[model samples]
Target: MSNIIEIKNITKEFKVLNRREGLKGSLKDLFSRDYKIVRAVDNISMNITQGEIVGYLGPNGAGKSTTIKMMTGILEPTSGEILVDGCIPYKNRTRNAQNIGVVFGQRTQLWWALPLVESFKILKDIYGVTDKDYKDMLELYQSLVDIEPLLHKPVRQMSLGQRTLSDILAAFLHNPKIVFLDEPTIGLDVSMKAKIRTLIHALNKEKNTTVILTTHDMGDVDALCRRIVIIDKGKMLYDNDIEHLKGFFGYYRTLKIRVSGSLSETAEKIAAEFPEFSVSANDEWISVLVDEAKSTVMDVLSQLQKTYKIRDMQLEEISTEEVIKKIYEEGVK
Candidate 1:
């Protein structure tokens, strides 16, 4: 498949005034050019192909949203190029909108008082979706999800999950070539989250819509994305398949143990003993992410048994969230 979205050396900068502490400073700031330029997105470049679901991940203020805004034509980049389906998003926003769909978190595209179907109808007209295509989309939704009952309900009366579901349906009603979903499953129950993930996957498969999903939830990334792009502090970090990214920390495993003493002190002691491993403590457990390649679990256990008493311990495979956390804290090692 051809690339549906192309972003090259994209940079977004914002100038924020350096405010003074008092009213005098605030007054000076209004007329003064003494401000700082914050780079929200820095020299990031990536291409997304058609029919692919990519997880764009980062913590808050990590420039994930800024990049999405540039792609969706809501904000123009300070430098570099962004082409969505062959059109410059900021330059040809109208044409770009026609070929792409968007669903931001908790922001309903549907009319607040309108029924789900009514919103769909308005979108159909706005996007110029044909009667045949519209019917086909509804049929696809029925096969993929049992949302027929909620179609007639007003968006205002719908639960958070139901409204989000309806919004997704409306986005795909036009059968756009690309869809940008920012935190699609935010604030949803586990079952609802699963449904939304399945819906997005099915839609991408059935309609071949390229999807760019920005989410903090690892479950959403694991379930819906084959590839992921991670950025932090406006800098591109990792862009690869989930398996390949996990390979970076393949030798690592979590060792969770119940310690009798103060968790912080125990954790500090453990860290001092094993300077090589990443050790952290919580109220319940002192979790140590051990790189088994350097030292075996039994070796570490034997060494630890001499000083601190380990009441209960469990070994777990390193999770996606853990690996990403490590990356964020220490960068790619």
Candidate 2:
């Protein structure tokens, strides 16, 4: 597939008024303006292909939102270029809108007083969707979302999950080539989040819809996105497949093993032999940090099984969220 979105050395800068102290500063600001320039998005670039789900991530005040706004044509960039399906979004917003969809979880595009179906009707008109196409799209989404019953309900009366799902459905109603979902599952229950993730995956898999998802939820990234672009302080930190990101810190994995026979005796011997590994035991569970570079989990487990009866074991790799947090706190060297 070809590149559906291309961002080349993009930057967005804002000028904020500098004010003095208290009422004096407030009143002086009306007559004279002293402004400071802030770079919300520094020079950053990435390419996304068709039928790909890319996670655009960053901490608060990072350039993630500014980049999204530029891509969706909501804000013009300070410099560089952005092409969505070969058209500059800010330059050809109306034409570009026809080929793309957007869903902001914290905000709603649907009319508050209007029934869900009515809002869709307005969108259908705005997009110039054909009767056959609209019906077919609704049918496809209904199978994935089970939103048929909520079609006639007022958007204001619906729960957050219902409204978010409705927003997702509306985004894909026109069968756009690309969709931008910003925090689509925020503030949702576990079940509802799963449902929404399923819906998003189905849209990308069944219809080949390209997706750009910006979220703090690692689960959403894990479930739907294979490739991710992480940014901080308006700069790109990492852009690669999920596995590659994980591999950056894949040298160690935490192992929690439950041993039934002679807990204290087994723990003492295990710790004695593998003093190089950080080993500890508490409540019949042996916790060890297995260094993948030096020793494997299988090697550790095999040694333990021979010494004691090992009932069960659970291995956990460093979570994606934790890795991202580390990058945000300390520069990814």
Candidate 3:
């Protein structure tokens, strides 16, 4: 597959004003000139292939937003290059806008007072979409998002979930080959979130849309993306297949145990004997974090049963979110 987006050594910086103290600080910030350069996006590079859905994840203020802004032509990079659909996003703003779609979860891009259909009409005019193409897109989006019930409803009267779904439809009305979604499912109910995820999957499969999704929702990443690129502290930490990343942290396992009696010191001793395991207890229940490669859950359970009566036991694979959290807490040093 051809690359749809190529970002090469891109970096962005912001000038932050320095303030002194109290009332003087406010006055000094206005007149006294002192500034510090904050590097929002450190040098980063990656290629997004056409028709691929990529999950772009990072902690807050980690340059995920800055990088997306640079890619969408909302902000210019201080250094390096960003190419979307073979065009420089910042240099060719008009062309880039026509070729790409963007949805921001925190804000609405549709006309507030207009009916949903009217908003679509306005977008059709803005993008100069042909009559036949507009009709086809409208039909497809209606089926995908089921917006017929909301078509005549004014934007101001619609719920946040409704408005968000409408915004997503508007972004893709032009049938842009590349779409950028920033927290698209944030703050939505489970059913609505599932609807949006289904829509995204359908669009990628049917239209061959290349999607770049930035979200804090692990569910979104798990459901929609095959590949993930994670960044932290303005640096890329991991960029590879999601399964591969999960396997790297696969050694960590969780063992949930239900005990007939209180967890004893002997149980603690056995857990302590395993150098790679960590144990935590609450009331009649005990949870153990074990290194599956070094000691299996069965080993822990077998020792516990030999010493005490076992009520119930279950083992679970470590979640992706927990693995990522560990990575963030302890950098790849």
Candidate 4:
């Protein structure tokens, strides 16, 4: 399959002004600014194929947002290239916007006072949709999202869940080939988040739309994306299948045990022994971190049981969230 999006050696930099202590210093900075160039997005490259849903992840100020902004034509790159459907996003923004849709979680593209249907109608006109295409697109989304009841309600009056559903529908109304969703499930309840995930999956399967999802929610990543690209401090850390990413860091496992009393000493000893694993404790409950490659969960539990009375025990595979956390914490050195 052809790549729907290609980013090559992309970098973005911003001039940050240094300001000294007080109100007087703030005023001085306005006229005589001492600027430091901050690299918001360092040299990065990735190719996203058609009909694929990619999870883009990073901590705060990790340049995930800066990369997305550059891809969507909201910000021009300081250097390098971004191509969406074979057109340069920054240089040919109008042409690029016609083929792509973007949703920033903190912002809404729909009109607040208008009803959901009205907002979609405005978008349909904006994109110059034909009557037949408009009807088919609306029907397809209404069935996929089940937004019939929410459509008549004004956007401001609807709940967050309702508005989010409507907003996603609005983005797809133009039948864009690719969509960029930034925190699409942010601030949603568990049920609502599930619903959105289902809708996204259905959209990809039925319409073959390429999706680039940027989210802090690991649940979203686990549910929706087969491939994930991780970024930190403006650098691309890893880009591969989810399973491969987990195996690459093979330093995670969960150890749960019930021991006599608090077992604080044992917990402290275990933590001290394995500095790589983080440890936690509760009354009569001791949990130790186990690196699968270093020590199996069974081995750790058996050793602990010999040292202390163990009533109950369980082992869990490390979660994607924990793996990502370890990667960032350890700096992939």
Candidate 5:
């Protein structure tokens, strides 16, 4: 696939007033000219392919929003280049806007007092979308989310999940080639979140829409993205496939087993057998650190069952948050 979004060594800096502490300092600040340059995004570069769902992630204050704003032409970068589709986003915002869609979870683009469908009609007129195109787009979106009931509901009266769902539909109404989704599932119920994820997945699959999803939700990343570009302190830390990122953190998984009795001896024997694994035992409960590449969970259980009566066994993969936490702690090693 061709690269639809290319950002090369982009840097975005902002100048803010440097206010001093205390009443005296505050008085001085009224007459004094003090400023500081903050680099929200510093020398970050990434390429997102057409039809690829890329998770653009970072902790709070990690410049994730800055980068997205630059990409969407909301903020111009301090230096370097950003190419979305074929044009520089800031230079050709109108064209870029036509080619791409955006959804910010905390904000709504719909008219507060207008019926949801009325908002859609206004957008259709603004975008100059043909009636047939609007119908087709609505059909595709309706298949994923039941927007029929929402059509007549006033935006202000809609629930958070309902309003968010409407916002998502608005974003894709124009059938843009690329979409930028920022915390699209934030504050949503579990079922609503699942519904949104399923809709996003279907949109990507059917339309081959390029997506750059900025979110802290790991489940969102795992369910919708294959590749992840992680940033920290305004710098690109890790940009690779999800599995590769996991491997970079080393094999981190836990296998727990319950034996009838005397778990200490079993734990020791297992630890000795797999010297690399860290093992612990508390009564009948035993936990082992496992690298699936080296030994399968079933293999460990099979070996243990040979002597001890296996009461139960369970396997758990390292959570996505833990993987990101390690990245933040280690800093792109």
Candidate 6:
């Protein structure tokens, strides 16, 4: 497959004024030469193949937003190169806008007072979609989502999930080659998240639209992304499929145990016993994050049994959420 988005050694820096407190200081700060250059995105490179749904994972302040803005023509990179469908996003802003769509959470492109259908018509005209193409787009949406009931509802009147769905629909109304969705399911319930995930998957398969999703919701990553890119401290850390990423810490495991004693005391004892592993306790269970390189699961279990009786225990592989957490705290070696 051809690469739809190519970013090479891209870097973005912002000049922020160090404003001093109080009006006297604030006035002088306006003319103050003191400024700090914050490198929001370091030298990072990735090529996204056409029709791929990539989860751009990162903690806040990790440059995910800056990277996306550069890709969408909203912000220019300070250094390096980016090409979205063969056009430099910052240099050819107008042309770039035509080839891509974006939906930021809580930011509706649809008119607040206008019906959803009216919004679709407005977007169709804005994108210069032909009559046949507009009709075809609606057909595609219908096949994937039940958009009829939402057609007459005004954007302001829709619920959170409904409005989010509408925003995504509006973004895809013109059938752009690529779509960027930021926190699309941030605050949605499980049912709506599932619905939106299904809608996005169906649309991607049917329309072959390349998707770039940035979200903290693990469920979104698990459902929509075959590939994921992880970044931290303004630098790219890991880029691969979920299964492949898991291999980085394959020896990692989570052991949950129920003991016939105080959870906190049990937790403290376990922590002291294996200072290398992470140990925590809730109301009913004492959970430990074990790195087998430091100690095997059986070795940790036997040591735990020496102190307190193990009532119930379950050992499981590290989860996607835990993997992400680990990567954020300590980047993959």
Best by lDDT: 6
lDDT of 2 at 183: 99
Looking at model 2, residue 111 earns an lDDT score of: 97
What number of backbone clashes does candidate 4 have, counting pairs of residues 3 or more apart or in separate chains? 0
Please give the range of 10 consecutive residues that has the lowest summed lDDT in model 5.
Answer: 243-252
Candidate 1: tens digits of C-alpha lDDT, residues 72-109 = 89899999999998889999889988988899779998
Better of 3 and 6 by TM-score: 6
User: In candidate 6, what residue range of length 10 has the lowest lDDT sum?
Assistant: 242-251
Task: Indicate the worst ten consecutive residues by lDDT in candidate 2.
Answer: 245-254
- Give stretches of model 6 more than 4 Å off: none
Which portions of model 5 miss their true places by more than 4 Å? 256-313
RMSD of each: 2.0, 4.4, 2.3, 1.7, 4.1, 1.6
Which lDDT tens digits does candidate 5 get at residues 186-299? 999999999999999998998899988999899899899999998888998888889887777577788889887567887887888779777888856799877777887778
**TM-score to native of every candidate shown:** 0.93, 0.84, 0.92, 0.95, 0.84, 0.95
Q: Model 4 over residues 1-333: C-alpha lDDT tens digits?
A: 999899999999999888778999888988975899999999999999999999999898999989988888889999999888998888888888999888866578899999888988889888998989989987888777777888899989888887777778888788889999999999999999999999989888888999999998999999999999989999999899999877776657788887766478777877886677778888666777777888787777776767678888877788899888877777676
- What is the lDDT, from 0 to 100, of the residue 264 in candidate 5? 88
Query: lDDT (0-100) at residue 45 of candidate 2?
Result: 92
Residue pair clashes in candidate 1: none
- lDDT tens readout by residue for model 2, 216-323: 999999898999999998999999998888767557787889988777777777788888777778877888877788889889888777877778898988678867
**Predicted structure 5, TM vs. truth:** 0.84
Estimate, for each residue in 91-129, the C-alpha lDDT of model 6 and write its tens digit.
Answer: 899999999989987787789999999988888888899
How many steric overlaps are in each model, in order?
A: 0, 0, 0, 0, 0, 0
